[model samples]
Target: MATYISKNLISGEEIVLTAKNHWLNFFSKDWLAYCLSSNEYVITNKRIVVKEGIISRRIVEINLSKIESVTVNQGVFGRLLGCGSFTIIGSGGTRETFRNIDNPVKIKRAFQELVS
Candidate 1:
């Protein structure tokens, strides 16, 4: 009954993802546990790097199973432009939020593929 988790890949297996959530860029185990349990993920360099404005401080990775739900949030203005945000809920331990994204439909489809 929980959502959100983080993890790392090791020897063809994935380890849990942990963070302090104290200062961006810096990371430590803030919670008790974290894991991206599913095998579904997105791998778009330009998307998370340039378009998303995320730094290389961490790798471009996310666990599809850890995701609770995918939401496309369009602000009043964003709804007009058709560009918006992505809200992902992981197990009980982790959460990821992305903004000003494009082609959310494709992303949703990817998640569907993982579950189906």
Candidate 2:
């Protein structure tokens, strides 16, 4: 999904940052398919947005104020490569996982700073 966040952006909302899918995704058996599946994360002034999917469409939005916690998991290789999965937990126990995302630490920090 080649989405132009700028075009879809709501009035008064601006993207503070953007992230792409991790390089580790290349290791999957169906690497081509993985590439076709666009996985991106966008951080705006008021919310965190994740757009991803292959067959069906999926979009997740979490208001910064409602974010309870953010967790990152990196295996040995993942840590060395600086790519991994992260889970964003919202207030009321809602959770969303973005796997094989690039620069997870930086992404987590951005979210944490905004949420705090």
Off by over 4 Å in 1: 1-56
What CA RMSD would candidate 1 show? 12.7
Q: What TM-score does candidate 2 reach?
A: 0.86
TM-score for candidate 1, residues paired by index: 0.46
Distance from true position, residue 64, model 1, in Å? Answer: 1.9
Model 1 lDDT, full chain set: 0.40
Cα-based lDDT for every prediction: 0.40, 0.81
lDDT by residue (14-108, candidate 2, tens digit) is: 78889887766778753664677566589998888887766666889888888888899999988998889889999999999988888889988
What TM-score goes with each of the models?
0.46, 0.86
Provide the lowest-lDDT 10-residue window in model 1: 45-54
Encode model 1's per-residue lDDT on 14-110: one tens digit a residue: 3222122112112223221112221123432112111112222233344555567767676776556555656666678555766544445455555
